[model samples]
Target: MINAKKLEEIAKQVSESLPPSVKQFAEDMEGKTKQILQSKLSQLDMVSREEFDVQTRVLMRTREKLVDLEQKVAALEASINQQQPESNE
Candidate 1:
């Protein structure tokens, strides 16, 4: 989740950009802007940076294990092939 201070800062900046005539409603604008921003952001499907990093590490480990298993299977196939010719002789 985004930090509340950052959201407040963003809302303040947005409200400050209004014309002079709208200055009277600056506080109200800021609050509404913050509420809208939070609501929209929450509706998005997203993950935090930490969770993304953890999932990336897990994927890397799984790939490494898959590669290792593939090599073992290849070596076993080669051993079986080598013994087959001798059994035929």
Candidate 2:
């Protein structure tokens, strides 16, 4: 989610851009702009930086476990193949 402070700063900038005649409504405009920004931002599909980092770590661990299992399976298959030839002789 976007930070509240950053949203407020954006709203202030927008309100300040209005003509002098609208300056009387600057406060109102600022509040409305902030609400609109928050509403639109919330509608987007997004994740925080921390959440993204945590998911990346989880994926790395899962890949490591997968690789270890593959190596163990290959070793077991090789051992079985060797035993099969000896048993047939």
Estimate every model's Cα lDDT from 0 to 1.
0.92, 0.93
Q: Which stretches of candidate 2 lie over 4 Å from their true place?
A: 1-19, 22-35, 86-89
Worst 10 residues of 1 by lDDT: 80-89
Which candidate ranks first by TM-score, i.e. highest?
1
TM-score of each: 0.59, 0.54
**What would the TM-score be for candidate 1 when compared with the true structure?**
0.59
Cα lDDT of model 1 by residue, 21-85, tens digit = 78857668999999999999999999999999999999999999999999999999999988876
44 in model 1: Cα distance from truth in Å? Answer: 2.0
Candidate 2 similarity to native, TM-score? 0.54
